[model samples]
Every structure is written in C-alpha cells, then in structure tokens.
Target: HSPYFNGANKSTEVDYVQVYKDVADLLEDNDYDDGSYGPVLVRLAWHASGTYDVDTKTGGSNSASMRFEPEALHGANNGLKVARDLLEPIKAKHPNISYGDLWTLAGVAAIQELGGPTIPWRPGRTDGTSAESCTPDGRLPDATKKQDHIRNIFYRMGFNDQEIVALTGAHALGRCHPDRSGFEGPWSEQPTLFSNEYFKVISEREWIKKELKNGGWQWVDKNNTDVMMLPAEISMFNDKEFRKYFELYAKDQDQFFKDFTNAFAKLTELGVPFKGDEKVYKFETLPVVVT
Candidate 1:
C-alpha cells in the first residue's frame, strides 16, 4: 500500500533514494574537518568492504561488522566512529534498512555530493548480529607500507592494478588526522571537493619525506608543505604499473570518474548476497547553487 514497499522482500522494498537524500543532508558541518563528513563516510564504506578475502570470502560490508568491537577498534578504522555515529539518526529513521546498506549508500551519497561519480548501489545486505563476524586486524592497507603491501591487501579482495589505482584516487577526498592515523594533512589542497587532484598532486608536486612529531612519516609537498601523501600513496609513483594509471587519471578527470565508479561499486558489493532481481539504483546528485 505504501509507495516505499513492494511487500515482497522488505530489504529491496525500502526507498533507498530517500535514504541517500538523508545521508546527503548530513554531510556538512562547520565544526567538522574540512566542513564535511563526506570523506570519512567514504572511508567507513571502504573499510567496511575492503576486508574481503577472495580465498575464504570471510569479510566485507555485508556484515556491517565494524559496529561491533575489535573491528570498531581496529587501527585502520580509527576515527570512523564519527562517520558511523553521524548516520545513526538515519538508521533510526529507517529502522528496516541494514547497516551494511546504509553505510555503503552513505558512501555513494558522499562521493556524488562531493562532485565525484554516481555510484551504482542496491540493498539486500543483512547485518551480522555479533562480534563473531568481525574481520581480523590488518586487513586494511597500512599507510606506512609500500606498494607490495598495497597489492597484497587489495589482491586479496580481487582487485587488479588498474582497479587498485582507481580506488586509491579516493585519497582525493579526506585528510589524515594527527590523532587518528598518526599522520596529518590532506592529499589535495581542496580535500572536501572530489576530483582528479590526488593524482594531479602526485604528478605535479615534489614530495619531501617528513617525520611527524608523532614519530610517523609522510611526504609533504616540497613547495606547499601543507598537503601530504602517505608512503602507500607515494608507492603509486614509484611502481611502474601504478604510475601508469595515476598519471592517466591526473590528465583525465572523466576517465578517473568512470574507473573509480566501477571499482568502488565493486568494492562496496563485495560479499553482499543480493537477490538477482534487486534493482540497482543510481540516485540523482544534488544540484549546485551558483553564487
């Protein structure tokens, strides 16, 4: 009887377009970092899904396991509680929606609202009831590590070189917080606006390795000194294969959008068991207001 329901599978019947709008409306706040929760929301979806291991198929956003202990306290997921807590009211509003679907959809909303690509999304993921479904520590990429480590982590999730490069372009959005990641600063000058800037910075800037007061290492742009890159990102420049893709993305924003949409959609869907008939929804982006 309700327009939001087909009365068949309840998960598929919930109006996800409204959910997207709800999440979009909460992305900005003056007190928050760079004035938006968009970046961290993207990270929430990424860490939730990036844990998938192709061999065992044990991890992914399907469980929304990060809400539990161990995974919530994971070092890689540090500071993500802000993103989760921000979405809590939405979860309360849409009681029937799965945490997995809500988080991943929030990610799609963040990207689109921040001027990135439209991510194809759907619902059907069910929440894991307890901490037993949590992924082990170290499933995420370590910023201190090199290209080899990046490959090992992503390869386990079934992404190849190009997809890996496309996914890393997400560094374009958020900054590393000193208290959270033990690193500081953003990869792009405009950290809140999504673009090809992450790759462009890598290609254009001369990065000088700097040791933080926290005893961590990151590369600062030799000229600007404010923007930074983690060692894992610098590895993209050093590795021949990785370099090829980032370089291309630096020159072409359209290509970057296309590849990133595909790779990120794949990342979020990992381990999700969607009934074949569930419709894929592409929510409309909010209109820009010109000054």
Candidate 2:
C-alpha cells in the first residue's frame, strides 16, 4: 500500500491532505499583499503550467521547471520568487513531494482559503534537473496585447474560448505591482476575496486608459482610477466569442464558480502524468467566514 506509484517514476507516498492544510495555514500574512499570499501563489501555479505546448507536447507543470533560473528569470515570471520562497519551507518539510505538486497544490489551497471553489487535484509531477527544461519565452500571454494575441496564447495551451474566459476571471484577486508587471491596481474592489467581481468589472465598469509613470498603460475605472484591467482583459469584452462567457459569469456567480474551478483545475493539471486510477482529491475548504 505504501509505494503507490501514482504517476511519478519512483515509488513515493505523500499525504497530500496534510500538505494542503500546511499550505492553507500559510496563506495569511499581515505583511504580504492583501494580507494574503493567495493571489501570487495562484500566479505561480498558473505560470508554471501555462507554458504547455499542445502540438510539441513540451513544457508545463510536469517538471516544476521554474525552479531553474532560466524559467524563473523569464519576464512573465517576474516576482514569482516570492511565491516560491514562501512555499520553500513547505517543500523542505515534505521532501518526498515534488515541487510540481507543491506549487500546484498551493494554488488550490490559496483559492479555497480565499473563499473560492474546491479544485479537483491529484499528485504525480516530478522536478526537472536543469535549465534545459525551461520553455521558451513568449509562451505566456502578454498583458499589453489584444484579442488575437490572447487567443493565440491560450489556444496553444488547448483552452477553448469559454475556458479562456473562465481562466482570465482569476484576475479578481491581487493587484498588479508596477515594479513587477509595469502595471498597477486590482481588477476588482475586493482583491482578496475571490468572486465574479472580475467578470462584473469587465462588463459593468467604464474604464479609462491611463498611462503609467513606468511608460506602460492599463485601463483604470473611470470613476475610481484605482482598480484596473489589462489590455488582454479588455479584449474579453471586445471579442464577441470571449464576451459571451464573461457576460454570463458577471450575471451568475454560481455558474462562474463552477466553470472557473473546472478550468483552473485543468490548468494546474496540464501535462501532469497521472495513472488513470489515481484518487482525485477534493480537499476540504475552511469554513465560510460570516462577515
């Protein structure tokens, strides 16, 4: 019963439920952004897996390749070291668990702890050895690009239009740091609590394009100017295909939660090799906060 070679090449046993708890416990920090590391942890998991190339079958979360300098130093990955560093202690405590598993699971923990849906997840990713495993640059979507560019990026990762829109709804959490992404502000007023606010923002708010002091520009709310949306996010509204789903999500929080969770679960699991019979773990979330 111990070996249970779920998907890893070697025999290993991991108590993923305990790992989930540990990651969840670490989500809150009064010193970090939004007093929670949830958003960046989600970003870390996303960047790690978003590199997948469906045609070539290369890249993805399979190897936890971001541990190598080449991938970590990639422009799209800027500032993710903070997420990795936070999870380092968790990794150190559980040496048998691969970085691929830890990073993805941490993302799930972040979402659930932040009042999002429970993500279906399993383990079986192993770390790669060298920088050679790093995916090429430009694989991740550019925040400055528009609809065509957004489609090109996500399409390569095998996401269709609906999934594409559901995935981008993740922007609801965490603000963009000007120092990191050369953009600033949260897409939603409640940046820490995950909800359909991002969809609502895209559909309802009138955004004004603001030129940042850093020489880059993003759309800020016409009224507030504090919250913002990337050019790529705006594309969701302009494109007829992408517009359909975000419009639906903005109106239906339950449907948004369902689709977003499914899309995100798929995102984290991209290219991860797991045995067909591997247990799908739906880790329990913290009790709902009564505010």
Candidate 3:
C-alpha cells in the first residue's frame, strides 16, 4: 500500500503511517548543515512538545500556533523557524495534516532517515486556534544547568530520570551552535546519524577545561582537537546516577534506540489521552548511500 500510489487524497483513507514515511523520504532528500537533518528535526520536535505544562494545560503540541507571533518570538525558539520553514512545502502538499502532527512526524522522519529505531506515532493531535498561542520563554531546558536543574525542568513536563536520559540521547544527532545555544561544536563527528556516540565520547575521552574568551563554560576533548561539550551535557558524566545509564547506552546502540523511542513517544504525548489501545508504527530503514 504505497502512500503516493494509492488512495492518496481520500481524507478518511489517509494513513498516518504513510504520512510518516513520506516525511522520512523528504528528510533523506534534504539533509543539510551536518550531512543529516536528524539534529534539527529532534530539536523541532522538542521545542514543539516542550511547550506543554501539566498543571496549567496552557501549552502542548496540539496548537501548532508557534507559527503565531509571541511563541515564535520566544528566545528559546530561535533557529527553530528554519526547521518550520523547511517543512512548509510538506505542509503545502498535505494541507489536511495539522502542523502539530507534521512537526512530530518530521522528527520521526529524521530519526528513521538517519538509521534510528521505529518511533510509534498516532494522529489525534489537531491544530489549535490563534488565541491558544504563547508559552513563557524559559520552558525549555537551559544547557548551562546540572542534574537537579535538568530534573526540575523535565519533571515539570512529567518526564522521569530514564526519560530524561533517553531524550538527551538526541545530543548524538546535532551540534550546539555558538550562535544558537552559545555552545560550539558537535557531540559526535557524525552528528546527523542516530547512535549512542554521545555516551561513548563521555566514557572514552579525556576532557580539558576550555579557555573562556567570552565568559561561557565550554570543554575541549583531550583526544580530539575539535569536539566539545556544554556544562549541562558534561553533568551527565559528573553525576554518579546519570552516568550509570549513560555508560549502558554508550555500550549498546540498540538499547539506546529502544529506550529513546519509548521515551520520545511518551514525551510527545505529554498531556494527551488515547481513547483506545495505543498503536505503534515501525518505519522502514533507508539504505546507507554515500554521496
């Protein structure tokens, strides 16, 4: 049952799973900046889902209103419109799909496109009204904090320690831009592919304190001249408890993928409830073709 080949336009006949595959194809076709689109796609999904607050019910992925003024203007949301704009053509092709669903689907697309595990996604999320716009600026995690801070921010969004570690595994896919997060360089050289390289680097490399030219905390890898890490990311190494899971993930990529997929699935569904049994979709993996 090909998506473009059969029943392409029937609204009721639209398979959400096919939409996921279509977005995956698009991501593979347009991987830029780091040889892959994985990182930005992960960040796009995070920014979209991070807006949810369990207590207030004020923000969540349901709205897709980040297209509006105040939410788009958020300092934490900087560099994200690049991702949203990249998806505009896809949205244009499939007007019936909500932006909420599209953004999350893009994340799944990026992951599978870059050789990650299957992410189970569903389609009950609908676009919200313009009135339902604007989340506070600091809803996202600060890259300068420690374990306690990570716990506070993520816990506020209903994530546990395991989920936090799993979600942070996304660091393996994208680098911190000095312009965006004020952190420079990538966690792994292959920042586009999904893997447990972040943990491997932390466990295997020797880190030296980076010179502070502009009063920011950064680190240099003892083994490599170019790789770096943020204070927040390094804390995963400094803390005893966090390091345990990090080491486990570092040793096994498959375990990391499994844990990450489960955690990401939970992360995207922060405040939504399923009316029936939950369904998980496994996407096909693309061949590794070097260009």
Name the candidate that leads on TM-score: 1
Candidate 2 has what TM-score?
0.94
* lDDT-superior candidate, 1 or 3: 1
What stretches of model 3 exceed 4 Å from their correct place?
1-9, 28-31, 212-214, 277-280, 287-291
User: Model 3, 1-291: lDDT tens per residue?
Assistant: 788655655764446666766666666434466665557877888888887787887666777768888888877788888789878887777778788878887888787777678888876567777855667777888877777888788888888777788788888887777667677788877777788888888778888888655578787798785788878778867788778888889888888999999888877776555566645656666656688
In order of lDDT, best first, we have: 1, 2, 3
> How does model 1 score by TM-score?
0.95
- The true-versus-predicted C-alpha distance at residue 22 of model 3, in Å, is 3.2
> Candidate 1, overall lDDT?
0.93
User: What is the C-alpha lDDT profile of model 2 across 1-291, one tens digit per residue?
Assistant: 455554564436678898999998888899887799999999999999999989998888989999998788999999999999999998887889999999999999999888889999988887898998899989999989888998999999999999999998888889999879999888888999999999988888898899989888889999889989998888768999888998899999999999999899988888887877878899998665588
For residues 1-291, could you state the per-residue lDDT of candidate 1 as single tens digits?
875565556654577889998999888898998999999999999999999999998999999999999999999999999999999999988988999999999999999999999889988799999999999999999989999999999999999999999999999998999889999999988999999999999999998999899877899999999899898888868999999998899999999999999999999999998888888999998777688
**True-structure lDDT of candidate 2:** 0.90
Q: Which ten residues in a row are the worst by lDDT in model 1?
A: 4-13
TM-score rank order = 1, 2, 3
Candidate 1 lDDT for residue 21: 88
For TM-score, candidate 1 versus 2, the one ahead is: 1
Clashes of each: 0, 0, 0
Considering only N, C-alpha and C atoms within 3 Å, which residue pairs clash in candidate 2? none
The local lDDT score (0 to 100) that residue 144 gets in candidate 2 is 91
lDDT of 3: 0.77
RMSD of each: 2.3, 3.2, 3.9
